[model samples]
Target: LRADIYPTLESPSATDWADRMALPVASIMWTPVASVTPDTDIRRVAQVLLDTRLPGLPVVDDNGLLTGFVSRTDILRAVANDPPLDVWG
Candidate 1:
């Protein structure tokens, strides 16, 4: 939905907040949005993000409600924080 929201986010000239707010949510929202579960593998999550070309994805529960978000930066940070393996040892 980020792409859908992007067009309405900024304009060439100043925009009226009231006008933007009045627009129907359906008109601006994307359909069939993808999401992942809490138990989803990190590798699968990475693949989904790459395929969707999104900065992040929603983390949903079994009931299909959003619990949190997982982002590219979050994955990168996890990798960066891990101690490097002693391959030569």
Candidate 2:
């Protein structure tokens, strides 16, 4: 299960630990299915993250296969570099 859903499992609504362990992973997973291409500009990636309220997104290739994952930290690092990546650059 995703860490994002951890709090929900601790709430009163959730069953006890033993019962939760028996449940399926699919029920609590955060599967936004959002992704970006390797060459997609940083601006677009930031926009998608904001729209989905997700911490990160999967990076896919032209064949629709997972290549890597991009998180908000990655974007921040890019912008904070000595020569920050510009929207046009």
| Top lDDT prediction, candidate number | 2
lDDT of 1 by residue, 1-89 (tens): 43345555554233555665679988766578799999999879989989988899999999999999999997777666666545576
lDDT of 1: 0.79
| lDDT per residue as tens, model 2, 1-89 | 23464565445344666575687989866566888999999999999989988888899999989999999999899877847666675
lDDT, residue 5, candidate 2 = 47
Taken over the whole model, the C-alpha lDDT of each candidate is 0.79, 0.81
Error of 1 at 23 (Å): 1.6
Count: clashes, candidate 2 = 0
Q: On a 0 to 1 TM-score scale, where does candidate 1 land against the true structure?
A: 0.69
What RMSD does each model have against the real structure? Answer: 4.1, 5.2
Q: Quote the positional error of residue 78 for candidate 2 in Å.
A: 0.3
Q: Relative to the unseen true structure, what is the C-alpha lDDT of residue 14 in candidate 1, on a scale of 0 to 100?
A: 38
Query: How does model 2 score by TM-score?
Result: 0.69
